[model samples]
Target: MILDSDTTKVISILGNDYTIKAPEGQEQALMDAVTMLKSALSETKRSYPTLIGDRLLVLAALNLCSKQVELQRQHAEELSRYEEQVSATVEVIEKTIAQG
Candidate 1:
């Protein structure tokens, strides 16, 4: 099935047709990526792609790793801020406690 007004190429995987809109002349690249992903997913002897299959696992792992790196950076920043706040609060609290 093809959509008339979409710039995206239609790719069929796991019996479902997905229309992806890519930049001009990038359809082939998209197709190539899909092919690679599908081939990776085909190890289970099924024509259709499985979400829980090995290929999917690898893809998910790659994506998760990328996200994890980003999250770690953000977490480090947050931790720095929190530590500064705690240090300031401790300094104030220590002065008050000593005064008492």
Candidate 2:
């Protein structure tokens, strides 16, 4: 189903219902993100049963954010490597054309 920008979806997380607004065709992506968050929260809860409410959410957010940062860093490094390879390939092609 397609959802407009104003569409609100009610999703359950941590035993609570939340109304979230998302763009069209992105409902599944939003739900998937929420599922990941729920998993993180659940795992954190299991490791630290004493943590509750805001603290638990914060910890989960921190964990997800850390992972995101690391992934982004890795992605940037890979992109840089690809760009260098492309540049070298272009230079080699230019040299071949000049020698031909």
Best by lDDT: 2
Q: Estimate each model's TM-score.
A: 0.39, 0.89
As for model 1, its CA RMSD to the true structure in angstroms is 10.0
Predicted structure 1: clash tally: 2
How do the residues 71-98 of candidate 1 rate in per-residue lDDT, one tens digit apiece? Answer: 9999999999999999999999999999
> Which residue runs does candidate 2 get wrong by more than 4 Å?
1-5
Report residue 68 deviation for candidate 2 (angstroms): 0.4
Question: Residue 23 in model 2: shift from native, Å?
Answer: 1.4
Candidate 2 Cα deviation (angstroms), residue 59: 0.4
Angstrom error of the Cα, residue 33, model 1: value is 0.4
lDDT of 2 by residue, 3-82 (tens): 34666899887678999887878888998999999999999999999999889999999999999999999999999999
Structure candidate 1, residue pairs in collision? 8-20, 8-21
